[model samples]
Every structure is written in C-alpha cells, then in structure tokens.
Target: MLKMKPVTRQKVNIVIDILMFVVMAALAVIGFLIRYTLISGEARWEKFGSNIEMTLFGLDRHQWGFIHLVLGVMLAVLLVLHIVFHWKQIICLFRRLTPLRPQRYALVSAITVVSLLILISPFFLKVELGESIRGQGERGGRNVSRTSGAYLPSESEDRTPLSSEVLNELPQTQAIHQNQNRRHGEARMLEIKGYHTIGTLAKNYNVSAAKLKNTLNIPSDVSSNERLGRIRRIYGFSMREVEECILALQHSTGDQTQHNNSQ
Candidate 1:
C-alpha cells in the first residue's frame, strides 16, 4: 500500500478526532432527549399514532436514530483508521514496556474489563424490548386514527369527527367522540366476559381487526388471539382508549347496517 505523507496523515487524524468528538456530543444530546421525552411518550402514544414528531433540531426520533447509527458506524471506521495511524507510536510504546510480568497481566485484565463494559452498556440501557419499535400514545398530536376510514378527527382537536359513512353508525360513536363517557352498562371486560382477546372484541363489535390494530397501534406481528389485558399491559396505554376506539367502530358498523336496512 502507498504510504500517506506524515503531514497528510496528521491532518487526517486531527479531522477524524474532531469528527468523532462532534458525533459523540450530538449522540449525547439526542440520547438524553430520547431517554427523557421520546422514551416516556412512546409507550403511551404507540397505540394512538405512528410517525409522531419527536423532534430535536428538526429531526424526529426515527430520523435521529438513523443518523446516530450512521455516525456510530463512521466513528467505528474512523477509530480503526486512527489506530492504524498511531501504529508506529503504539508499537514503540509497547516495545518500551519491560519484559512481560505480573504487572503486564494485570494491565491486560483491566483493559479487558473496561472494554467489556463499554460494549455492554448500550444493550442494558436501551428503552425497547428486543428489536421492536416502542412508545405510542395520545401525548404526541395523534387525534387522527390510523384508519381514517374508521374514524377522523373534527376540525377541533377536542372533538373527533365521524366520516360521512359513519353517520350510519350507532349514535354511540358521536357521543363518545365529543368526549362523553360510555353508558352505565356497556361492560366489556374480563368480569362480564371471561378474558376477551382483540379477536373476540373485534368480532363481537363487528369491527375490523386489522383497522383496530391500526387505530390502537398494535404491532402487526402480534397475534389477534392476544388478550386485551395483555395488549393493554404490553402497549402501556389505558384500556379505556382501546374500548372507546372499538365502540366507535362498532357503532359505525351498526349505523351503516341500520341505514342499509332502512333503504
């Protein structure tokens, strides 16, 4: 390989050092914001909506993560280059170390422990489980349902609007959309009905299981057979939100049926 001139190599090293430092600083701030804001809000909002703008410096969490990943990879590459650049110095320093002894063994052990920690910290510190996306709720501006066909928000954020087709839906959707609570005996829980799953809930109410997933932000990979209690716990949102969305859809389907019958 053609050797780089000493002057050119030094300049490259300085530039890499600056880039690495800047990237680390940016990652620090982004990581902090993610920990405090995005991490907290994600669980709550996941069901409400996706593509929520968890912004810092005009970038959302997903965008920031992608950038972070790129920078991290770049930093790793730069580090390799840095080590190669310092190879001569490193060799001389090692050469100067006296005959390998107990002290040398101790030094190697210390370095190994430190390296292990540096590599392991991230795995334990991550917010989400496994490789799945997390954090979802009404916290970030997510009034609109994922299935706009099922539900649409009114011009006012306070009230949700029904699609024209939903006019045929049961009156329940309208009342609840206005933030009115459900009726006294609209019980749909484990107490009234033993262990309801998303599948049964959708089936009983005549709602779309697929759209319910979209509205509630249930990850596609999860089985419809997954119990509502489990869903509530895993998704980290109130059961109330899930119930309301289902009721609304049910009412819509009912109203459409009523309309058809009338015609």
Candidate 2:
C-alpha cells in the first residue's frame, strides 16, 4: 500500500485548516451582508425609496445566498475530511473519556448518530405556516418584482397614494398653508411604507411632521423617529392611512398654490 509521508500529511492538514478558516470568515461576512446590508424588501423600500434589488459586487441577495450555500457545503466536506484524517486521535480520545468498552462504543455511536441527524433535520423538517402579518408577504425576501425592478402593489388596499375616501379623512397639512407660494404641484408621491418613520416621511415627501401627525391623529407620545409599523400596531392606524394623508397633503399644497396664483 502506498503511504503518504508524515511531512506531506502535515502539509495537507495545514492547508485544510487554512481553507476552513478562510471559508468560515467568508461565511460570517456574507451572512452579515445578507442580513444587514441587503435587508428585507419592506426595509429596502423604506430606505431606498423602492424595493430596489440589493446587490454586493454586482450579485443580488439570492445569488449571494447561493454562494453561501455552496460555501456551507464546502465547509461540511472539509469537516468530514478533517475527521477522517484525525480518526485515530478521535478513537483515542473516546477511549480516555470512558473505561467500559461497550458503554464507550455505544455512547460514541449514539452521539455521532444524533449529531448527524441534527445536521440533516433541516431537509426533512416540516415548515409550519405561521399567521402572517398584513403586508408581510407582499414582497418576499430577495424575491421582489421583476417589472421595473420596483415594488408594484396590485390594485389593492395597500396601494400608495391611496383612494379618495381615505384621503378625505386626513386634515389639510399646515405646511401647505404656511408655504402658499411654493409650487407643490411638483411634489411627488412618496413610496411610503410601515417601516418608515414620521420624520422620514416629513423629510422625503416635503411635508410637515407635526401636520402629518395631525392628519393621522397620531398620539403625542409617539416619537417622530418611531417606525409607522410599531405605531400602527399600538395606535390602531394603517400604512394605507399614512399614505392617504401624505397624498392629501401633497394635493392640498398644490391646490392652494393654484388658488394663490389665480388670485
């Protein structure tokens, strides 16, 4: 039988160790990038004005996820090879752990089987569908709309610049009255979502934070920086209502501008 020299075996072990370390570090960084940088669809819309496909180095989140999976598989294979290389050491360690031969063998076998089963469980696991929050599934993570690469709502309740009835419910914004000469006709509909804050809406949509609060009938206690989603859950408001108020404010501003110009 052809045998590997001890020096060659040592070199191979060192290479495997280096590869494993590199793979682990890569996995950690990619995992953080996917979780924090790419973020969820709703969060992307809130931050980037739309559900723009988040990418790193020209690869989208799903593509990075695929690479992550490949790296995970490679790590698994490396681990198996590492174990094979050190099998004798493992056996010796097990012997030292327990004196009774039968008990030691049985315990080792049981632990090995259980560890493997835990690793394999994800494949066979039945994923239960939990009660989804409203608008949670509108844009699935990393699977956004292909058309225009922007989040397009169906003709549904969640649509931004919402219907007339909701808009009618909101009061006229103070900013519109305060800046009568300003051409709000140029004011565009903001891609508002529950993830946005009152401050964010005010800044991005060119509205008044105080007036927005009034339009939404938001409580005084809620901070401007607080997310609309959390505020809605507690205060019985909807993202639709927020969007309606924003559109109404824009319209009111424009109408006031037109009236002033005519005068």
Error of 1 at 27 (Å): 1.8
lDDT of 1 by residue, 1-263 (tens): 99876677789889988988987887787777666665544443433333234566787766777877887888788788888989999767865693566767788789889989998998888675332222223322223333332344445433444543645443443445554322222222211122567788777666788867766778888898987666777786555566566756654665566667888
**Model 1 Cα shift for residue 125 (angstroms):** 18
Model 2: per-residue lDDT, tens digit, 98-186? 97999987997999999999989999999987433222223321121333322233342244423334334544544323322222222
Looking at model 1, which ten-residue stretch has the lowest summed lDDT?
Answer: 184-193
TM-score, per-candidate, Cα-based: 0.38, 0.56
Best-fitting candidate, measured by lDDT? 2
- Which RMSD does model 1 reach against the true structure? 15.9
Error of 2 at 72 (Å): 0.8
Note the Cα lDDT for every prediction shown: 0.59, 0.65
Off by over 4 Å in 1: 1-8, 46-53, 96-263
Of candidate 2, the 10-residue stretch with the lowest lDDT total is 179-188
Total backbone collisions for each predicted model: 15, 0
